[model samples]
Target: MDVIYANSELICSTNASINKCSRYKGQKTLKKEVTVHKWIKVSLIVLSVCLVFAFGGVCTLAILLSHATPLAFFNSDFSVPVSDQDQNATDYKAQFDALRHQHEETLRKLNRLNYSTGCALCAVHWIHSGGKCYYFSKFKMNWTQSRDHCVCLGGHLVIINSKAEQDFVNSNVKVTHWIGLNDLETEGHWVWVNKQPVNDSVEFWIKRENGIREPDNWTKGHPDGEDCAGLGHPGGETDFWSDAFCSLEKRFVCEAPAAV
Candidate 1:
């Protein structure tokens, strides 16, 4: 009976040993599974971080590209209060508006002062030296004849002094009345009948031909060595003149100071 008991004890001890080995093997397997789960979790977290960083980088790049190129469709309407931008836009707009208003006012004043517009005027018998008339006659004679006639009238042909005055006279002349201008006295050195040097800079001349006296100085080819300059209505055209002889018959444009 003791021997039977010893065999049973041996069998039980063997079974317990086998159970312990199985438990050890199961524990090892569980440890491997936990390690694998931890590895997967770490990899997932790293991937998520990378994706967030990549998304943020792409968004930043997109914004920078939009700023550097014309791809941005949004126009800052400036209706919003400026926080980071230059704040002078409003001030610049105000200054521009003020300048525009001032320009308009100046133009109004000029229009009131000069009711006339032309490059030259005829029959300007009045220069208001405070207010008085300086009388003289301008014959639409050839350059030479015009000079002689103006001299006879006790004054030389008018010399265009200013753009405004020139335009005024030219507009009112109604004919290309002879003025105190001719290259005949000297080539290219045009002088008024009063012998005042012609200021080509102030008034420009149109040239049809080349190689004369400073074609830049000639107003549509004046004083082409013609002895006469006649201003009269020719063939129902606005009166303009060609070089002619003084013997031709035509009306005269007289000028004098405005009668007080």
Candidate 2:
């Protein structure tokens, strides 16, 4: 009886030990499954974050490309060499300067043309004839004063050198006017204002019908000696030069070179 009881106790102890071991193994398997599931979830989350960042980068690049100008894309300095760029800038500047010079030259030529024409170059109320400009003054002044006035006007008193010029002055004068011929320095030796001696051979002095010549210095019996010359209708003879007193106030003619 004792032996049988011993064998049964031993069998019961072995069964309890086996059942505890089986339960421990089942718990370990459940822990392993939970760890694997956690690893899979973490990997899936990382992949999703990577996919989102890649898509956002692509969209930002596309937006930038769309907003950029066509020229901006082509204007990059890397496409052209530095020396070529400098050469192009120099060429462009040279072309601009050339065009500016051409424009200035054209303006100068137009101004010269306007100045060279006869009547167009003369001042208002001035007459142009024989490459000269003449101004007939309406006011009266003494011979010296008239010469000074002509000087102030950038000219001198009329110096008639030919019959045609004498005729022109005689025909244009409204009344007796002072001319540039005078013997102010030495009496009876006539000279032009420019200091040239007058040639009496081709002189335009009026000759009377009785063969008497003018410039007789005859001014109503008062002979301080007429030193200044004038052109007018003296003795009913027009287009003739006559010596007159320097102090006599008379209308004058001024002459200047015509602008060319």
Candidate 3:
């Protein structure tokens, strides 16, 4: 009878230990699950808040968040890993710059009234982008006339330095607008309003379907040939540039540095 009691006590003790271990493991699992759930909730809230802030015309919140940390925009260190193996970290500076530029441009388009009516960095009726202010003309003028008008407004004809600037102009203009590119001094040698030679790397000339490239110096009427560059020709084509007679009256875009 003593042997039976001793064996029963051993079994009860073993069962009690097993129960304690099981309870501990269950609690541990519950804690891990709760942590994951909380992380997910916070992620959702951050994304929703960013969207709301951006749409409310206060996208500077997004910028501030980006500047907070190198990984604030991507969150690799504290993010929950879905895979057992580690994921490679990527350099997203280029992508982040592009996103920020696009976001600012989108905001300008969304609230043109506020931006155009009054800007701290730009004049009333001018729009700011990439540290520059642009004035899109509402009236038509010859190339020389337009250039002079832009000068009168403390600016020059728009000079496109990069693809981003080219894209910005493309998005803003609806009709064929005269650009800063011209070959007036030396035919076939295009120059910008800043007197800088057009970089072949960034030129956006049109290639004809037959494989012919522009600056063909095709003359419409004048003996000097087409000396001015115009983009988005009406009803003929859009998204490519063509040389036109400088005497032709057309709308133009002016560019100037933003106020300090």
Candidate 4:
């Protein structure tokens, strides 16, 4: 009976050993599987990171290429050539200069026309001839008073400087008119209202064939004392200027520069 019991105890010990060995093997296999699973997850994470970086790099390169100019890439100096642009700028400048010249020429022509046609610049009822404005007075006044009136009207007494001007005055004046020619400051030294001495270069005094000349200082009471000159009908010619007393009242003509 003792032998049998000893044998049974040994059998139980062997079975327990076998069970412990099986449990150790099962735990090692589970640990190895868990380690392999962890390594696989880490490898997948690294590969995903690599793919994300590669996609980002590709997107950045595309954006840079989209914004870059084609000419900048083609030229070695990286500067745009200015041949066409310079030619266009030169053409524009030439066109502007031509327009400016045309404008200046048009202004010059307008000024010339204004000078040629005096009536274009004169006021109503004012006659324009030889680049001068003339106004014929309707009332009568003395020489000094007439000059003062003309000055008040922004002009002076009519100063006859040429035969054309004299003819114009003769055709316009309906009655005797006081002129600007006078020797009031000095006898026989005639000067215009503008203080210019009367010279033969611009003189328009009428000369008669009968040995008589105009501005003869021909008045009844005063001979040489007749200082003021006037244009009137005196016997033979109707467009002759004669000196008369300064106090005598007569119609007058005023002259001024033509308005531009």
Best candidate, TM-score? 3
Q: How do the residues 1-260 of candidate 3 rate in per-residue lDDT, one tens digit apiece? A: 99999999999999999999999999999999999999999999999998997787666766675467645524556454323223323336566567757655754564565556564367789998987889999999999999999977767899988899999988888889998989899887899877899998998898888998787887656677988998856565646788888888999999876643
User: By how many angstroms RMSD does model 1 differ from the true structure?
Assistant: 20.7
lDDT of 2 at 246: 86
lDDT of 1 by residue, 89-176 (tens): 7778788788767655754554445445412222345343222223334343445565566545444566656665555555555544
Model 4: which ten-residue window has the lowest total lDDT? 76-85
Model 2: C-alpha RMSD to truth? 25.7
Candidate 3 has an lDDT of: 0.81
TM-score each candidate. Answer: 0.34, 0.52, 0.53, 0.50
* Per-model lDDT: 0.52, 0.79, 0.81, 0.81
Give the 10-residue window scoring lowest on summed lDDT in candidate 1.
127-136
In the predicted model 3, the residue pairs found to clash are none
Ranking by lDDT: 3, 4, 2, 1
Candidate number with the higher TM-score (1 or 4): 4
Candidate 3 C-alpha error for residue 98, in Å: 39
Each prediction's RMSD to truth: 20.7, 25.7, 23.7, 25.3
- Candidate 2 colliding pairs, count: 0
Model with the higher TM-score, candidate 2 or 3: 3
In model 1, what lDDT does residue 183 have? 54
* N/CA/C clash count, model 4: 0
Candidate 2's C-alpha runs over 4 A off are 1-120, 219-223, 233-235
